[model samples]
Target: MRILLASPRGFCAGVNMAIDCLDECVKRFGPNIYVYHEIVHNRYVVDRFTRIGVKFVDHPDDVPVGSILLYSAHGVSPEIRKAARERKLQTIDATCPLVTKVHLEAIKYARDGYNIILIGHEGHDEVIGTMGEAPESITLVETPEDVDQLPFGPDAKLAYLTQTTLSVEEAATVIRRLEERYPGIEHPAKEDICYATTNRQDAIKALIGQVDLLLVLGSQNSSNSRRLQEIGVTTGKAAYLIDGKAELRPEWFEGVNSVLVTAGASAPEVVVEEVLEHLRQTYGATVEDAITREEHVTFPLPKELRVLQAAGA
Candidate 1:
């Protein structure tokens, strides 16, 4: 069997920054650190941090007053920030700058009196946070069909924003529908889907039909990871989302000659290698990289961490 590994898979710039922020926090502040949510959506990443004494909380109020709190990579709304401030917690923001951009767009659209249409899953953490920016102004739509169900009339002032980790093709289709339905609809200054999500989905599209089976390495709750698996299924190929090699089943390889393996942005590369090694031992699979694009994006650490490092130095 031949295994095609997706190039540019796993550990995108945002994930790297979030993980590094937590690592620095733990190193400097010790184990009593608290995170507002899973730093990233990956279970392994969260578990690793949990082992180091980091506590993940769903609400700002859950955190004890005067304790240190770090926001997750999926940026929070201004309301959450306000709550954290009211709690008098020492806060470190680990929000991905790209996610921060979407929040800013939402705020700008609301302030300008444009009814905002957000294209994303209903309950996703990123969507929820972005929506909280202007709950009264924003409407969430997951499909092109949902565009028709929008309460706004044709003449309403309108603008659209999207979750940063959405499937590129799906978001485009929905955007097209929105344009047709509301010819006067406004758009963000830039595309809302982040570069890493686009590149990973593009890689999957590039290799879809050539492989008999597609394996996506990521946690189930990860939005971008789920989208990658959905793309594979849409292509009419067998696709499975697995956390690691432990989830692999021999039956999946039955009558399958070629397998494509890819990882989500939050997944660690070492886990991908473990999956590859499992395949090699089980099926004697020869590995080859399917490079779709090269990514060189990097985000600086949180400002607080930078200040701390400088002070310590």
Candidate 2:
């Protein structure tokens, strides 16, 4: 069997910065650090942190007053920050800068008196946080069909922002619908989907035709990972989203001679290696790298971590 591996598949720069911030916090503050949400969507990453005394909470009220709280990479709404402040929690923001950029765009568009249409899945932490930025002004749309359900009139002033992890093609379809409905709608200065997401999807597109099956290594809750799998399925190839090699079924290889392996931004490289090792041992697969685009983006550690490092130095 032949295995095609995608370059720039696993952890993005933003995920790296968020994970590093958590590691630094754990080292400096010791056990029992509080995180407002999953630092990233991967279950493996969260479980590792949990084993090391990190506490994940769904609500700010769950944390003790005067405790230290780290916001997740998904970014929090101003409302969440206010609640944390009310409890006297010392907060460290680990929000991905890309997500933060979307939030800022929402706030700006709302301030300028435009009705904001945010394209993302409902109830996702990132979407919730972004909508909270201007709840009264922002409407959430999951697909092109949702555009018709929007309450705004055709001439209503409007702007659109997107989740950082949406499928590029899906978002484009939604955007096209929005434009058809409201030709004068404004848009963010730049595309809101992050670079890592775009690169990973592009890589998968380059590999799909060459492979009989595709495996995406990511937790079920990971938006970008789900999008990758969707892309494979949309291309008429068999694809599965699995957390790791342990979830891989032997039956999946029955008629497949070539498989493409890729991972989400939040997934660890070690997990990807484990999957590759399984393929090697089971099918004696010959592996090759499919490069779509190279990524060199890096986000700095949060300011609080930087300050802590400077103080220790």
Candidate 3:
């Protein structure tokens, strides 16, 4: 068997920044730092942090007063920030700047009296946070068909934004339906989808049909990872999203002569390497790294951390 490893598959800039922020926070503030949610969607990443004493809380009230709290990269509602402030918790926001841009768009559209329709999977952390920007003004749509049921006036000054980690083709299909239904409705001045998501999906599209099977290394709850699996199925190729090499079932390798491998932004490259190593051991497979696009993006750590580091220096 042969393996085609997708390039640019793991640890996108935003994920790196978020994880680094947590590490710096721990170093600066001690192991008692509380994160509002998983800093990133990967289980391995969260488990590693958990072992290091990072507490993941779903409710702000559960966090003690005076404790330092970090927001996840998925972002959070303004309400969450308000609650943290009310509780007098020292706060550090690690929301991906790309996700923050969508929140800003929602706020701007609401201020302009536009009814915002956010395209995203309902209940996703990023979707929930973006929707919370203007809950009264925003409606969530998951599919092209949902666009038909959108409740707003034809002249209601409508606008649409999207989740950063959505499938590029799926979001485009929904947008197309919206455009057809609401001819003059407004859209993001720039696409809200993140660069990493777009590039990863593009890489998958490039190798979909050529491979007998595809393995996406990502957490089950990861939106981008799920989209990668969907993209493979859409191209008529068998694909599975696994958290790590341990989840790799021998049955999946059956009849798969050419397997393509990739990872979501939140997934670690170490997991990919482990998977390949396992495949080599079990199936005696040869691997090749297929370079797709070059990504050089990097995000600076949160401002407070930077200040602390400078002060220490």
Candidate 4:
């Protein structure tokens, strides 16, 4: 069997900076440091941190006063930030800058008296954060059908933003619907979808024709990861999203002459290697790295983590 390994599969710059921020905190502050949520949506990454003494919490009040509390890469609402400040937790933000841009856009639009239409899956971590920015003004829509149900009048002041980690094609479909429905609606200065999300999906689209099966290395709850699998299935190819190498099944290789392997932004390269090793041992798969494109994005560590690093804390 041939294994077509994706080039730009795992750990985008935002994920890298978020993980690095937590790593610095762990090294400088020792164990029991609290994170507001899973630093990223990958189970393996979260489990690794949990084993090393990082405590994940759902609320700011759950963290002990004067202890370190880091926000997740999906970002958080101003309310959550206020709560942390009120609780006196030493807070460090690890929010992806792209996600932050969406939040800021929401704030700016709402402040300018525009009703915001946010394109994203309801209940997603990133969606929840961006919505919280302007809950009174923002409306969440997951599909073109949702757009049809919107109650906004044609004359209502309108603008649209989107979750950073969304399927690029799906988001475009919704955007097209919004454009048809409300031609005067304002758009963000740039697309709101994360670059990693777009690139990974584009890679899969570019390579799906050559492989019989596509294996996405990521957790079930990862939005971007699920989108990747959805793209494969929609393209009429066999696809599976798994958290780790152990989830791979022998039956999946049945009748599969070639496989395409890729990972989500939060997935670790080590997991990719483990999956490759398993395939080589079981199926004697020949691997080839398929370069889709080059990505040169980087984000700086949180100021709090940097200060700690400088202080030798």
Q: Which candidate leads in lDDT?
A: 2
- Give the CA lDDT, 0 to 100, for residue 198 in model 4: 92
**Comparing 1 and 3 by lDDT, which wins?**
1
Candidate 4, superposed: residue stretches over 4 Å from native: 311-313
Residue lDDT tens for model 3, 171-197 = 999999988888888987789999999
What is the alpha-carbon lDDT of model 2 when measured against the actual structure? 0.94
lDDT of each: 0.93, 0.94, 0.91, 0.93
lDDT of 4 at 18: 95
lDDT of 1 by residue, 1-313 (tens): 9999998899999999999999988888898999988899999899999988899999899999999999999988888899999999999999999999999999999999999999999888899899999999999999999998988888999999999999898899999999998999999778999999999999999988789999999999999999999999999999999999899999999999999999999999888999999999999999999998999999999998898899993
| C-alpha positional error of residue 153 in candidate 1 after TM-score superposition, expressed in Å | 1.7
Q: Compute the lDDT of residue 57 as modeled in candidate 4.
A: 98
> With candidate 4 superimposed using the best TM-score fit, by how many Å does residue 10's alpha carbon deviate from the native?
0.7
lDDT for model 1 comes to 0.93
Per-prediction TM-score to the true structure, in the order listed: 0.98, 0.98, 0.98, 0.98
Give the distance in Å from residue 124's predicted Cα in candidate 4 to where it truly belongs: 0.7
Q: Given candidate 4, what's the lDDT at residue 178?
A: 96
* Candidate 1 TM-score versus the reference: 0.98
